[model samples]
Target: MNVALWIAAGLLAVVGLVGGALKVVTPKAKLAAMRGGEWTQGLSDGLIKGIGVLEVLAAFGFVLPRMLDIAPVMVPVTAVCWMALMVGATVTNQRVGQGKLAVATVMYLAIAAFVAVGRF
Candidate 1:
């Protein structure tokens, strides 16, 4: 169980890091210009950046506290946050008819939920 939870947390952390980094770095216009606009549509630049910040923080939270044996509860908390973010992503993808993106979001949400449950 510990090994499985660790794996889940690691996967979520990497995903959150890369996805959040891209959201933080990429220009809003550029993302909106992409096909289907599923990733950035219906969201303001500030909001997107804020979400990115949350994701980045969650990424660190997923690993750092638990790994260091300090405030390990943050692992589950971060997993919950990750699930919320993925839920939003799923909705966004659905709104834009981006089936693939929606599927990916669902997968992330499932993984995050698993981590949350395991850690908690």
Candidate 2:
């Protein structure tokens, strides 16, 4: 179970890191262009970038304390946080009528919730 949790954490971290980095680095115009100009429909660029930063930090939160054997409780805490973020993201996508994005967010949310429970 521990090994499985670690693998899950690594997967989450990789996705979060890459997604967050892209969000941070990519221009709003580019993102908007990709998603039919609806990616940031109701969201400001600043808010989007902030979410990116949080994602990156959350990825670190999942790995750091556990890796250092310090405040290992933070692993589950981070997972919960990640799940909450995904829940919000899913809701937003649904509101925007982005069915595919909502589905993906739900998958991420489920994974995060599973990790949270398994790690805790």
Encode model 1's per-residue lDDT on 2-110: one tens digit a residue: 9999998998889888978877998899868867566676789999888888888888999999999999998999899888888888888888789998998899899
Model 2 RMSD vs true structure: 1.4
Cα error, residue 116 of model 2, in Å, equals 0.9
Q: Pull out the clashing pairs in model 2.
A: none
lDDT against the true structure, per candidate, is 0.87, 0.85
Best by lDDT: 1
Which 10 consecutive residues of model 1 have the lowest summed lDDT?
33-42
Query: How many Å off is the CA of 58 in candidate 1?
Result: 0.9
Which TM-score value belongs to model 2? 0.92
User: lDDT of candidate 2 vs native?
Assistant: 0.85
RMSD of 1: 1.3
| lDDT measured at residue 40 in model 1 versus the true structure, 0 to 100 | 79
